[model samples]
Target: MNKKKLIVVENAIKEIAKRDGVTVEFVKMQMKIAMMNGVRSTDSKAKSFWDNISGKGKILTPEELIIHTSELVKQRKSQE
Candidate 1:
């Protein structure tokens, strides 16, 4: 992690340790498990995303996909 994020995580762990009357090591272990679960969830989502997009069933050519993506960006900007 970057320095800023590391500091934030450390601060959070410290708070949790204080509130729960647990050692910093124990809080760190719980944080590690949470981070691992988050990584797994993100990996699963990305795999599903690729599986949906990478097949003969996907009809858009590269150029068409670019155009569609640009249109979606514009729509999002308008909504914002």
Candidate 2:
């Protein structure tokens, strides 16, 4: 990840942790669990979407997911 994006994600996670009275590690674990469940769920659309970004047989780490999502959002905004 680029330095700016990394900083942004770190700051965001820190903010979430502060707001929720939890540690950053706790926030990261929850994110990982949520992503894992979403990818493993029976929803074909969700699976397909993640497969496109993450690859068919690969699971992304929470940091990778956040980076990919940030890139996607940046792409969409540029297109708009």
Candidate 3:
């Protein structure tokens, strides 16, 4: 992983475990599993996942990532 991503995941491990009352290793493991799921979704049957827009498996542009992140923010707000 890049340094920035490494830092993000490390901090995420801390934060998620603290919030969930789990061990850091368990949070890290679940995070790794989620990432693997994304990769597997990409590799199998050309499914759309974190890196893609649709099943044909085209990589998402930065704009798409921003739009998706914004949607996630709105969705989370609605849940509360």
State which candidate has the highest TM-score: 2
Ranking by TM-score: 2, 3, 1
Pitting candidate 1 against candidate 3, the one with the higher TM-score is: 3
Clashing pairs in 3: none
lDDT, each prediction:
0.56, 0.88, 0.57
Q: Which residue pairs collide in model 1, if any? A: none
What's model 1's lDDT at 8? 58
Local error of candidate 2 at 72, Å?
A: 1.1
- Would you estimate the TM-scores of all the predictions? 0.39, 0.86, 0.41
Residue runs of model 2 more than 4 Å from their true location after superposition: none
lDDT of 1 by residue, 10-32 (tens): 67667888999998888766655
Per-residue lDDT for 1-80 in model 2, tens only? 67787788888899999999999999999998898888897999998888898898788877778899888999999999
Clashes found in each candidate (C-alpha, N, C closer than 3 A): 0, 0, 0
Candidate 1 CA-lDDT value: 0.56
Candidate 3 residue 44 Cα shift, in angstroms, is 8.4
Ranking by lDDT: 2, 3, 1
What is the C-alpha local distance difference test score of candidate 2? Answer: 0.88
TM-score of 1: 0.39
